[model samples]
Target: MRICFPVSQEKGWESPVFGHFGSAPAFVIVDTDSGQLEEVTNGDLHHAHGMCQPLKALGGRQVDGVAVGGIGMGALMKLQAQGITVYRAVEGTVKDNLAMLKEGKLPVFSSDWTCAGHGHAGGCAHR
Candidate 1:
């Protein structure tokens, strides 16, 4: 499985996951089968609030799943429409979350978990 993780910077497998999906500065994609990692720049990093274009943010790359600490409802729905399953990530590195994912411990992100707004004092509080 190709699992995508939004990150503030590239730190290989040890990179910490960013708090929000749309506004992350970068993304790390891990190929579970071979443990290969690819870094992608967030193409839509400056999109207006509540108008995130998930595919654009991902630079048009296809991923089987996304592991994020938080996500907006619109972006979540857009990703789901593309058959991509979003997973709620723990407060840890990519390596840590990958382990839980392999063990079937990561939970699927539901609508109720979506961020209400990005105008909060410190960004998305859902994280």
Candidate 2:
């Protein structure tokens, strides 16, 4: 599986997952089968809140799944429609989440778990 992880910066498998999908600075796509890693800059990083174009943010690359800390309803729905499963990322680095994913320990993100908004007192409640 090719899993895409939204990250603030590319640090190979040690990259920490970004809090919000739409606002991530970059993405690290890891090919689970081959252990290859590719970094793609977030193409739509500066879009207004709630106006995230997921494909654009991913630089139009196709991913089998997304492991992210948080995501909005619109973005989550859009990704699902594209046949891309979004998983709720754990609080750790890419390597940590990847292990959980391989063991089927990660939870899939549903509409109920989507982020309400951003810039809250602490962070996104769902995260």
Among these predicted structures, which one has the highest TM-score?
Answer: 1
TM-score of 2: 0.94
**Deviation from truth (RMSD, Å), model 1:** 1.4
Clash list (residue pairs), candidate 1: none
State the lDDT of candidate 1 residue by residue for 7-114, as single tens digits: 978999999999899988999999999889999999999998889999999889989999999999999999999999999998899999999999999999999999
Best by lDDT: 1
Candidate 2's error at 71, in angstroms? 0.2
**Model 2 lDDT tens row, 1-127:** 8999999778988999988899888999999999999999999989987899999998889999999989999999999999999999988899999999989999998788888886656356663
Over all chains combined, what TM-score does candidate 1 have? Answer: 0.95
